[model samples]
Target: MAAGCQGCRTAQHQFAIAMAFQPIVDVETGLPFAYEALVRGEDGEGAADVIARVTPENRYAFDQQCRVAAIEGAVAAGILDTSARLSINFLPNAVYSPVACIQLTLQTSKATGLPVDRLIFEFTENEQMADTSHVKNIVDSYRKMGFGTAIDDFGAGHAGLGLLAAFQTDYIKLDMELIRGLDTSMPRRMIVEGVLRIAKSLDITVIAEGIETLGEYDVLRGMGVRYMQGYLLARPGFKTLPPIALPGELYAAVA
Candidate 1:
């Protein structure tokens, strides 16, 4: 237990929670680079459904609870059998102290026999962080702890390049809106190509997420994007790892 952490007592008093896992596929191998854990209600409710009930009083508890659930759920789902990493989402604002906040996560990792190097924490940029400096601290602290950090929904967010300039994480997940119909849109392709160059210069790996069509996948692969995720590959599995839905032609093309 984290010493003097008050949120521990209030964790999950009002509800039960679980995790759904969606793999971020590595295009070269057609296997997962990592599986992103999504929070869900026990009966399989979506994230938006579960998040609407969170209040400030329980925010910290909920955040802690989510991390624990993601780890335990992933482990129980046999993540140790694979080479893929596990990615969990965290709220930057609820983290009062990075070291203090991560005690449980470290403990869960130890208990699950999942190495810290195989864990990545992803914080979305869709919501502007109340304190950019604090997030940088979180990223720095996580990196020091041998955990990878990622910025989710990169291009469609508020801070955009400003946040990227603030601190570069291990991975950037391009938003679905930017990847949508990318094959048919020259402007979108140009924007993504520019981003790929920036990521390369910074040594930050780019993961194109929310890809749903063959053309989008083909175009992204051609642009040198390797990691990807979304409905076209596999949907989030409720408490399990779903088999990747690979079309024979698509798999042969990528393989």
Candidate 2:
């Protein structure tokens, strides 16, 4: 076993994990664009509860297991029939060998009948990367394998802009703090707008996460954000795909 992946050996004895899915919508289409798989406990506890148990040695196993469970759970939940892709959050550090570690994910995708093309792997911004080149390698390998990559919780973690500069990804989910009170805060709007401009220039799709109100939705929509997620749309469903309910105004606009 690799040095960092020591945890993989004893991971199964430590804890069991599960997935909760939340929808990401396309306001223009008024349909499900993607479903983000969030890690949770087997009994449906919050992600933090399960993640707190991860040690350096076990993180690799934890990361690998999360991927398998997310796919299996989503398949059991009937996500494959929908056009929405499955977006799974991953720890870049847990990836010891990008190509080798991905074999199980590939096998899981085939076993579940989920297309590799429909899989989107997102890295959490909160996890500080020790070796950025490793992350780049992982991203490159995934892309080559026909999976989409994203940066989750953008603007809320260490070296946000620096990470972007290091590698371009398919998507960036704006941090909830940036979306909160966005309807009322001019400065926040401006900051988001600027980020939007940068993303556009780089051809990276931006999804505004943690949207909670019609006002926030409208502001972001008016600002040209095509994708969104959060309570205003749907909450995370335990091993289930929640229905997306777009605001009436958005529905009308799409119509």
Candidate 3:
């Protein structure tokens, strides 16, 4: 473990944090591919409510604890019996040493009887990471350990093609900003087309999240984007894995 992270490992969180799961579905197959664990509060508060309390001092501990909590919560909710993987969002900046930071997660996975391959670690571009090398190390280390890595919010923030060039991740979730008006916006479609081409060339899977309308879903489905997540499909269930619903036509096709 890095010396800088020692203090954070022992730090305690002031507020309670809970886990909510949102399903990521394979649109073509009309089946859930994974469930992304979202942070929530004990009193039914949103993620922003809990995020507002994370300071630099408590970030590492918070990050570490979130992993354990997500896995434990998923197991308690019977995720182990499902074929879908458990996707957990992580903070690259909070990880001092990827190898060291993952020990607890590994332990939790083993205790819950969830194989390491069943976990997918996702990180967004929202975090302002100072050291790109550290992030690369974390990604590479996790990949080496046989866990899936994903870049969340692909087009919404700091990391994009630049980060993709540095590290080839297993998945990239297209940001909702790009998907917001995709059904009507030619520019957005053009951009997504370009991104899709690049992802295909890189052998990375593209998941369009935050889908809420049939139009958006139709457009993406027509474009051959197989994976999707959003309220239109299923909202995040509190401490549970929600069932997925697909359109009748598409459901029949996939079925």
Q: Each prediction's Cα lDDT score?
A: 0.89, 0.89, 0.87
Query: Least lDDT summed over 10 consecutive residues: which range in candidate 2?
Result: 4-13
**Which is the winner by lDDT between candidate 2 and candidate 3?**
2
* Candidate 2 TM-score versus the reference: 0.93
Which candidate tops lDDT?
1
Score candidate 3 by TM-score against the native.
Answer: 0.94
Report residue 223 deviation for candidate 3 (angstroms): 0.9
Candidate 1 lDDT tens digits, 115-174? 999999998998779999999999999999999999999998889989999999999999
Query: How high is each candidate's TM-score?
Result: 0.94, 0.93, 0.94
- List the candidate numbers ranked by TM-score, top first: 1, 3, 2
Ranked by lDDT from best down, the candidates are 1, 2, 3
**Clashing residue pairs found in predicted model 2:** 7-57, 7-58
Determine which window of 10 residues in candidate 3 has minimal summed lDDT: 4-13
Collision count for each candidate, in order:
0, 2, 0
Tens digits of per-residue lDDT, candidate 3, 68-174, equal: 88999998988878788999999887888887778778988999889999899999987766888889899899999999999999988786788888888899999
Distance (Å) between predicted and true CA of 238, model 2?
Answer: 0.7
Clashing residue pairs, candidate 3?
none
After superposing candidate 2 on the true structure, give the runs of residues whose Cα lies further than 4 Å from its correct spot: 1-13, 249-255
